[model samples]
Target: MAENMTGDIISDHRERMLNLKKYYPFFRLIDTSFSNFKDGKYEILDMGYIVMAVLRFFIEENNFKEKDVTYPEYLDFLRLILKRDFGLDLNEQDSKEIADYIFDKIKNDGRPFEFSYFDPVDRKKRVSRMKIIESSIRDNTVWYSISPDAIEFYLDTKEIKDESRISVSQLLLEKMINSQNFRGGVEVVERINEEVNRLKLKKNEVLTILSGDVFAGIEAYEEFVKTGMKWFDDEEKLFKKNRDLIAKSIEKLNASGSTGEGYYRTMNEIYSLETQLKQAMNRHSELLKDCTEMQKMTDDAVRRAKLGRLRSHMDFTSALSDMIKRDNADILVTMLSPLLKPNIRKTFDLISIDDALMVKPPRYEEKELISNERPEDIEFEDEIEEKRIKDNYVFLMKNLIVCLKKSDIITLGQFADAMKRAYGEQILRNADFFSFFVNLCQKDEYQLGGDAGEDTFLDAYLGEGFKDTESFTFAIRKGLGGQVILSDNCMMADVELVRKEAHGE
Candidate 1:
């Protein structure tokens, strides 16, 4: 015979099943408690409730300082609970015997509750063992507390929630630290990190949905905000509080001036626990930062989807029909301005001066006047050209700000379409649209709130105090691959304008 070793047919079958199998022993232990064929099928009624109550008591006791929960105290508590709830009245000797019997079953007769499971990862059967409650001997008195595994098992018996996991894990880590269970603290922090990473992936999924459908994405995002993001601040405070507690614990341990295997081992576990907590905190912070970015991404996507996308744009079909009806093709120049050409210039040099002298010059071209007084300010053709470029830059920035106001993200292809619809198709013929973008890209990000800096061309609106723009902050970058067809003469690489999200937003 050969072995058939294919992976999970349903993917995660092994993981989910393994998790479920971990609870099997606990359920069976409760069901078969003190039941024996030799004794003619004796069983404890309400054994499940009693077991759960016992676990809760152990956890709550451990949370307090030196509660010293002992076996005799346990017997007394059990006696009271049994009499109150189960209506069982027994003598002191009978109570002790019943307590010992329950204790033996819970402790698996001084052995761990063990089970074997198939480890898909290792392709082998492995044994997992755990104690529902653990005991410690102090001054010849045994102290009992709930184990971390048992606490987690208790939590799993309820509904599975996303945010509850992180919050509950933090509380568990705190409990583990309080009980000096540093090794358990490491596992708790790891679980916290996994939850944070899961949220990060969820953020990306929401953004992807946002890109395609605004209404649906907004609904999903609102739900996400309610569930996970709402508790981010509170969770961060908990992280800091726990970190400080761990630091103080390490200091206290070192101050005890102890030296031995137990002391050093505890010291090493404390340091390891601190390192895991720090990593978890850093991961949590990164998730928060990513979430802030997602807020901007979602807001812009919704607004753009609502306002930027149009149902009607330039009707080139009707315009072309009219052009043909008028029996003139020159109208094609304005209508087909998407493929406009650059201006061609010709000048006469010294070699062509003789030929140029043969042509007559125009007479009386508005009779130039010579003034004796120098003008307050003189602007030449060069100065006029510079002014025109500046004015075009300002105008382009105003429209760019308009897009920025509507949305934080706009691609060049999208902006070009907007300009063609609002300003007219001829605007694309001007070189200034692309030129302004070039200057903006060179200047990088422009902050709109502050006073105008040296990069006056792109940031000029700052000094101008443009209304509705002061709230905006912009960054320009090379866009995802594509080309913006400016004209038949040239094509520009697509650019993306991103409004940078303010910190703490």
Candidate 2:
């Protein structure tokens, strides 16, 4: 019974392997290399070298365009590669023999093991891309070319060179533009989504790594800042261009009155692009905002860590406690000499002042002890406190708006820095005021308030921060250290006030 069970297990395993091989045929070509197997082992070798040779031939000789090679040409090329790269001398061997050997080796190849994957689209166990060989004949001359599937495998495994990556975003945009065709539109959307997901994952990874450790090298921090800023700038420009294209497309679609299928298709494509563009733009904004927040958090963490270290080194609390325990009060007094009053020489005797001792009982008026007493004329303390906070918020908001108006754009960090510098720490260090400023920046209306009338909405007419001191309120705007520029929609307008308008001066 045990033998039967073992046999059944083996048989099931064999069946699964067969299924995997059936679904993915490219596995057969993988084990073609003579070096992949050891001596006396019943195993197929790796044949990836042959694929590499084929690719090299096309790339080095520019034969990809030709797409075909004669029987003799193929043999000569393989013979030359073996001689040059593998140090094999096939000169004495017949060309026909070499060709037959290569063909037999390629056709009879098997993989090291069965590889399979679950296909979501087909909802079944599926194989990856396969079929690594393509050959044909015409008029007694055999021709050779890598099959499309083989080409795809090559591309998938190859590394993309830096030059090829110079305009990756541009290429994606082009692909999205051309994906209006029925066959590829879905794929294009999937690709875009995949890229966006990758970016989000990368951002998360960066934040996680940064959060885990605070004392990164200066060079690492510098590089991150530089690269991050550049990335934002470049992506922002690309998004703007995409927005313009979508806007124009929408306009064109609206103007055209044709009810043809082509028209409808184009319209559908335009809508799709619009949606994609919006998502991309939003993701871009999210990444920048997240980066900004992460930077602030990292800075705070590092500062705190440094401060903690400093306190550890400079701590004198234990010493003071020890002094008190030992009754070393005299030493403590000397140590605190700077804070103690200085001793002075006696200038007069206590008896000399006896004649000047006339002390009139201080004239006292009837006064009320006002502890815990309700006063009808005064506002409640809680109400007063709430009013103060509200007033501070209003003041911060007006200043922020004025700062934004003075410049076309500014980042939240820049605004914060400006607030600290111009107004001093009196307002920026206030938690409530800072929160109010951040809230204003997040408003949809304020974001779109870069336009003419919108930009001036937060002017002096609405708040006292813009009150004229001289000829105009010197609107203090913050600059963003030349790294990130605020989006036009989020920028506030700096407003100037004239005294004549308020009191009819």
Candidate 3:
């Protein structure tokens, strides 16, 4: 049955391959174009290079009118490229001859060149077809450009390494800033919109870097952090600079700008740039936040990995086996320390307390005498050998509440300081202490420090802070009224405490 199933799968694959061949006849055309040898003359006309040339041409001439390059113009461009780059001494005539042959093959193919792409959804390789579409013709010259489909296919199939990961957003942002006529017409606005879309796509790609089984590793996490941090720094600076430029442009326009249509168009351009800049900044913030979170998550994973290795080396069974090999009865209690209980519940057998208390005298035939006593109620030790972790949560909470009560509200830094003074730095050293405190503040038991009418509760405002200090400026409810100083270096969050309202004089 298994053999039959395997045969069926092979048969289906072959059938699909045949169907693909029939559906995409352009492959044969491309193959024939390269296979043809007119005395080894057209051998220099590489299909891959030809595709690249067309792509480069379309990119260079991005405008609608310019997309359609005349046949003579394209021939000239190809001649220059081949001669300069390939060191080929092909003249215009030879270049034209080769270009015509390539174009003829393309026209006859009726389809595009197909490249294999890994389809993550289907978990298989699928073909992406690429082609240059001939757009228009004038007199004797035919104008052509790359089709959107082909361009998209190329982008999707291309493998970009980390070193080559360029920020399209930064490039476009800079271009708009430098261009004198950026706010000219619909074309410029449309181009900006296109750039915005491209930026969004790039931003989404950053999110996908640490996703899936392909990159769910420590190395990927590190790469994500490195890339995201650098991008945030550079893009944030550009965003601010562009924002300033837009502000100045707006000010100038407001002072003495155009009238009617020009006025509306310029305002619209400013608004668009501002909106895009804001979005870019927001995206950078989110990416940075995600990178930070990924760092924490990967740190946890690394710690767990270490724990797994430790577990494999030092399980109870292995330790017990070692203990038995050494024949160390003195260390038996030590080996069983983890399993020893503070108090053992006794099982009540049918025997009465009187029977347990009674002593038995050995007969002459008996080997030994049995003495009975109720085991003397043995105490384990000063500390239980059960290895149970002590619960400090309640203890910490009590200390925190006492501090909060003393002061109407407190910052995380202040709280940490108080806790350090009370319980020493060891209690404050717990990594999850801040997170636990934040969660506790959100409970119904604690109230915000606002007047009778106002709605202010114990809330936290996120800010950059020093190490071993809170990253957020916290207050009891609406207790934070005035500006809180957030300094650099130690970046500690400011704390404010609001006094509870007095009931009577």
Candidate 4:
């Protein structure tokens, strides 16, 4: 079966090569040791070479460093390279076996030949067997084996060797378990448990609220009831009728004041009546709200549950892709950058060219100079109060200074230009003014403009002063509040710069 599969792969490659030759008549095929035919079919003499080529292409394309490579790394590398470079899609099992075969050859060839130095031992002769073992120990080629004699000989010879032999199965298992691609299965299980518990707790709370077994505070409710009864008793007709009865009760209470029994009886009656009135008034309000809230919560929970499985699957796949591409910075840059159009090859410098598309021109609101309230013939000596405060300009200048102090940008010149473009001319006078502030804020020791000292023109126009700089610094700090602050800074700086530098200034 394996031989037949190998023949099929060779035949496929030959057909592909022929198709390529039809399209490009000048195409040439390179000859290698493995490119040989036997029994009317190509023999796969150098499967290891083919596997290595695929692995190398993946590593280079993905920017995978040499140190990050592992057993499963070679497997994924083979899968991607086969699909991407040769347009060959391999299933999981085929990819794994291919990777295993490559690694096995590398391991075998890396060590010296085991049978080269020692003669075969005769088991019947104990002395000869012992001699053979000793001889094998002396030959380093025997280090690859996991046999008891090999292990004992290695331990006796070397002080730093591991006591246990590392098997291929153990290494492969460890690689799979530790790999970022497969490890997230544990996290998915944990999140599922958490979500389940949360749903259960919410359900219990809703059921409790739906039931009308709630108790009010005993003392406060009783006092409130007594006050309501007292209000009723104060009415003229009611009070007149109850006056004699009330006096009799007061007299009875006074006579039994020392006993304390009658006083407790009177207080209990008042509290009971008050509780009845309050309960009837607020009967359904609490229960209705609770049921409505519970229904809303149930709807939300159902929606989340419906999406949970799909979301989890998406999360796992995204995480796997991220893990595979973690070390491949160049590939990520290529994937993310919009500059990679069709067959165009993007260099490092050209990666950020798309940012130019983000630039937008400024807009201004025009107000009429004359109001409708004044007649066309009416003329008055109205003086316009020009309240010109330099605070905004000063603030921007100070900001530029702060950017310089942090060494985030070498010069404020470029930052000033970005600010002018983002905000418009009403705020920043022009690039010259922006450059002046940057130069004022920048250290004298640094050069004007080389790779080492690139200028930030936007920072210069905003302000080169310490306070403004500090504000900008604080705005860029990480977290929730920092985002708002940064946004405000950008808007204010952009707008003011545009307002001031509206002309070519």
Candidate 5:
């Protein structure tokens, strides 16, 4: 009965292997209990069939109708099956070999097993049935199991031909090259080239791998390209808008009619003041010349008197008379009584009589000097000083008008320099004149007063103030240095003043 029970178990194992093949064409039963029993040995079940059954269930469930599975997923499926069905913890290497055998059978034959089922009843009735089932299962199963080294061989060969890695690598390379980050793109292409070369892959195989990713890269590249195009369009629009605004501002400036006459008036005023200043300077030079000439005459007269004294013991009467006439005898006599010689009077009287005789009567050569007007020959020092001061004030007014016409901002330092340039050292001494200049320049009628006094405005407009008195002094000392000439509109009133000054009206 024990022998019979053993035979029954073996027959059942054979039937089970056949059924497993029909359901899972990708997996094959290698060795079963029946085959082992035929060799007169009974081994305890390892339940490898349970692993296969669960894997078959998974494949059917996921609708994986493929004839063959690749290495990685196949190995993973085997491990999953083992864990699910038998709770057997198989290591990675063991699971991989089992999966490899299954893959090989499916790849080669399109099916895992040669025999479909075993007839246990027929084995009892006909010995041939037992032999047939055992032979078919053993040959197919043991063929895979005998050389387990074949699994590794198959995997090494199959992995080389797997195009998935190559496909993904190619996709990555294409994406990187089209990316905006140019450096990163170059790096990715280099890495792809190195890897492809290292793998010893054929050009066609590499190209095929790369093809799949091309479309994906193109999609992303299109989006990036559009973004850049839009940015350029936006910039162009902004530029046009700004250009139009500037054009409008220029048109407005042209439409206003205040500029031309204003500019002319301001320029004329400046020129008139300049003329007056020149005249004052010339007068001062003339006075200096006269003083020098008078000093020379005095020296000559003294020398003549000394020479005459040596020539004549008669008290040098001719030299004394000449000296008194040259020195304004009447004033000298009153101012320097102690220095006057007693003989100087007698000599002066004789010289006076000779002067009266030599002086021709005025023929009234159309008296150049009018009775009410001062003579050109007579110079009044006080009047010259007053004219100089007036010229300086007029010059400052002219500058202020020009600056206002131009819509130019004049800083405090610039204003001060203008004053100094117009009036020289006199401006520094006259606080009232400085105050008047500031008040006049800042008037709305002059159009010189804007928001220029505000600290924020000044900081933005004027770069920085003079660092020291030397810079300020240097700025004011020259012809153009202190001038803050403005536009035509601002200088109109000043220009009118200049015209009046020119005609002396």
Candidate 6:
């Protein structure tokens, strides 16, 4: 029975695991189960919460494109948040010290956080490293942003606004784009590009190892090739397929011949995506060639190492063992004394030895009063707003389906008119209506799989109104329609909706 259950489970997730491993180091800082060097130093009240607070701050600052996020601002934020969130009233000096310590961990002390793990897919060791946040030199001072890996890691936890109709992609980046989940498609490709970067870094690691230690380098090179070369053929084919798809999309846009503002805006975004995709493709190709050459170079090194290629320095341990074997006990101490000598340094103690005698005895200590009563369940504004929007989604979908039932194909203009007639003109002005436009553009295509079936989040969000209608496949188009003037404040590019069976597709 256990084997039957296990048989249904999909276990090989090396690609997903590789993506997830990027965040392991960041969380490793706060995990009590794992030992970190700074664990003692960062032992603050709710250390994990504070760490997340700092990470969220970085993400928000980057979102706002703030160029002036320096240490002073960070210190100020730390001071205020500690007081507000945890009621830890710390002095200025102490606050600065804590802020500086946290900043170091967030930046990983200007070095990449590194880790190695065995990938189950290929049964090979894979090296993964990422900095949670990175800094840039701007005007001789540093400014920071959340690193790409961290951004991807954060995004991984978020569900797509419209729960993917099928799967986001059962396969690759191109399929994702084709599914009309545009941003997800772009980000998915970015992750693949990151995989290429990791492989390149792995190759360089092998070369660096080889330069110092021949045997270790040879082993590392073999492992690197084994992991990297796995994707060599698939990635090459994927790059071409994606680029061709992009070209086809571009062609479709040009073929539309619409000179609307929305048309040009979408064209510009596609152009930018095209440029980035080309760069990633080029980098991936070059990395493949470099890995192949490195493999050959490493093979040569292994051959030389087998022939007893010696490093520049003599092996100290081997020499010591030989001496001991020869029974040269008298000279052993003489030879080892200098190496084993205690590390020499100079330092002065801040506290004098005599001060210990003058230390006062402990008196009665008063602790802060603790409240035993259960705290009220907090309701966040974001959560409230999300709830409001989701409710809006249910109502809007209900009305839209009603309109679609009147006619097999419904255009945005038609739907808006029906909404204004059924509800009120004010409904057209609602932000929920505007948000629907945004989601539609992201995933302009949708269809009901069957009666009483909820294939996508859209179907579920449609409420009981959806189950009342028969099965249908509907797609919205931005290119074919003119501007949809729903309200004075809210205007959207005219979107045309067509049913799947109408075109016999």
Q: What is the C-alpha lDDT of each candidate?
A: 0.74, 0.50, 0.50, 0.35, 0.38, 0.66
367-416 in candidate 1: lDDT tens per residue? 77888986786554445765677778777877888787787789998999
Looking at model 3, the pairs that clash are 448-457, 457-477, 458-477, 465-491
- TM-score, candidate 2, is 0.32
**Top TM-score model:** 1
Model 6 alpha-carbon drift over 4 Å, by segment:
1-172, 181-184, 309-505
Q: Runs in model 4 with CA error above 4 Å?
A: 1-66, 109-505
Candidate 6: tens digits of C-alpha lDDT, residues 258-325: 89997877777677667767767787777778877887888887787777645576778888798789
What's the distance in Å from true for residue 6, model 4?
50
What is the alpha-carbon lDDT for the whole of candidate 3?
Answer: 0.50
- lDDT for predicted candidate 1 compared with the true structure: 0.74
Quick one: RMSD of model 5? 62.1
Model 4 worst lDDT window (10 residues) = 126-135
Off by over 4 Å in 5: 1-48, 51-55, 61-69, 101-505
**Which candidate ranks first by lDDT, i.e. highest?**
1
Count clashing pairs, candidate 6: 0
lDDT tens digits by residue: candidate 4, 357-471: 3243686878868666856652321111101122344455455444445444422334555555767754554323433443443432222112232355333323332322222
The 10-residue segment with the lowest total lDDT in model 1? 1-10
Clashes of 4: 44
Clash number for each model: 0, 13, 4, 44, 14, 0
Candidate 2: regions farther than 4 A off: 1-25, 31-46, 49-189, 204-212, 217-270, 285-505
User: For candidate 3, lDDT tens digit of each residue in 219-282?
Assistant: 6555545644555565566557667877877788888856788788778877866775665466
Model 6, position 189, has a per-residue lDDT of: 59
Cα error of candidate 3 at position 93, Å: 9.6
Clashing pairs in 6: none
